[model samples]
Target: MLNAVIIGCGGRGQIFAEYAKQYPNEMRVFAIAEKRDYLREKMKKEYDIDDKYIFSDYHDLFEKGKIGDVIFIATQDNQHIEPALMALSAGYKNLMVEKPIDRDLKKCILLSKKAKEYGAKLQICHSLRFAPFYRKMKELIDTGVIGEVKHINQTEGVGYFHQAHSYVRGDWANEDKSSPMILAKCCHDMDLLVYLTGSHTARVSSYGLGGFFSEKNAPEGSSARCIDCKISDKCPYNAVRIYEERPNTTGRGAVEKEGFSNLEDAMRKGRYGRCVFRCDNDVVDHQVSNIMFENGATANLTMTAFTKDCNRVTRVMGTYGEIVGSFNDFEIYVKPFLGNDKKYEVEKIESGHGGADTVVVADFLASARGEKEMCTPIDISIESHAMCEAAEISRRTGKSIEIADIMSDKEGALL
Candidate 1:
């Protein structure tokens, strides 16, 4: 059986590990490195790992020599590069790294190059590539059902509560610490656009701002913490209402999964209980990017935190027809200029990230075993990251940034 070691035992890492249980014969977790004692112990118990195989520091695991056939790096965005470089240097030949390999463009390029130099097989967790929804879309486009793509429009509706939880008060709230909203949240869209169009992005222009989740926008009577706010009952972002209430009104289970016994306890101990507006958050809540591809196709992408539902809505227009879809419904509608229209519904699966988590794990294991090539290898994944980096530059400078300019800078850095 293929063996794997997880470098971060957080929620995403755990999700990846669950696949091993689902396909016990294909692969299994042999070890884990987690900073949190509880989480590390949880993995150790679940995987039946020995104490010697559990590490609080990933560096320690790498130092002890190779422990598995593959390494899964699910650390935070900024924390990805060092472990990845170290893992490759330590003779690990297969790596599954979470996306945006690094927030900095230079670091991303360097890590990608280093993996190649080390002859490592690298897969970035652009998991959507393996999801059924996107896979069907790719099939339709590849068969020319939509004809030659002319323009595409896509939107990522970050539900209001989710925006507050992830972008306002969570680990990814700050651009300096993690990445810009475009990279942190919408790189998947950029990647999909590139993948579907099968063309390199030529130029990108974007506009965005951190509009609502800030101290200036805080309700007049709101307190620094939701637990102390006078309007906690009425405020939509009340941490207690979102976390403490059983089957919470917001319909999200992040706090429950966090194992917080009560709202008061969570407020006293966790960052999730902090007031969204009062937190040290700086990422934008809304952004729009316009892209021009080398093949003359154009695209527009909008990401916003004010939506009532969390879904990706996409409309792809081609020379002879168009395809429109929504992830929430797992459905697609296609209308041709000269033929009969069609509808498709993707069969739903339970794994997180739209059933991509498990499929990607399966693919990674297959790739490691020399059975098949990875769907989202580092070379293909890096293009999307470059598009995101250009979009962020355009957002800040108020000018369209050329992809060639970004690539040239990387070349100059290498020189």
Candidate 2:
């Protein structure tokens, strides 16, 4: 059986461990490296890990010199590179990392080069690529059903409450601490645009608007913390509503999962309790990116927090036909310029990340054994990440940058 070592051991990390739990014949969680006592203990008991393989720190696990068939790095946005670099140096050949890879494009490139240097296979958790919705779209586009892709438009509605939970109050609240909103949230869209186009980016420009989720926008009667706010009952972003009533609304890191005894006390003292408007978030609420592919294809991406739904709506217009899709429903409508329209209802796989989480893990394990080709490798993901980094730069400088220049300038900061 292939053995796996997990770093970080958070929600995403635990997802990797679960794969082993389900398919013990194919793989097993041979090692775990995490600092959180509760999480480490949870994995230890669940996986029946030996004390020899339990580590409170990843560095300690790495010091043991590469003891597994593969390593999965699911650390925070900024902390992705160090563990990955360590894993490669420790002689692990198969590695899967969570997206957006790393917030620093330079580090992203460095990891790619290091993987090449080590002759290792590296995969990024651009899990959307593996999702049935996008996979079907890719197949249709490539099979000549949509003709030649000429233009594409994708919109990601971050969902009102979801945006407040993730971008305003949680780990990704501040750009300085996490990543630019575009890279953090819309990188998946950027990656898919490149994947579907079958060409690298030629140029990219973007624009963003923030400040709506700030103190100036706070209601007149709203308090600083949702738990004690006088108008908490009326406020949509009140912590009590999302925490006590809808604790399972978002992914991990909820007070309920964190073992908080008092919900009100947690809301009063924790990051999620802060007012969406009064918190220290600087990421944009809305942003738009314009991209031109090398094959004369163009794509427009819009991400906003004002939408009622928390999914992507897409339209891919090609030379002779077009495809329209809604990720929320896993539906795609293909219409030809001269023929009748056809619709496809993708079979939803019952797993996380729209059934992509398990598929990607399976792909990683199979590819690690040289049995299947990976769909989202480091070399391919770098282009999408470059588009994101360039879009952020274009937003800041108000300039449409040539992707060629950024790619050629290894030491430049365009990425």
Task: Report the Cα RMSD per candidate.
Answer: 2.2, 2.0
**TM-score of each candidate structure, all chains considered together:** 0.95, 0.95
Q: Write the per-residue lDDT of candidate 2 for residues 200-311, one digit (tens) a residue.
A: 8999999998889998889989988887899988888887777665654452355634555566666877777888889888899999999999999999999999998688
Displacement of residue 373 (Cα, Å) in model 1 is 1.1
lDDT of 1 by residue, 253-274 (tens): 3443356655566676678877
Q: Following a full C-alpha superposition, what root-mean-square deviation does model 2 have from the true structure? A: 2.0
Task: Identify the candidate with maximal lDDT.
Answer: 2
Instruction: State candidate 1's TM-score.
Output: 0.95
Error of 2 at 195 (Å): 0.9
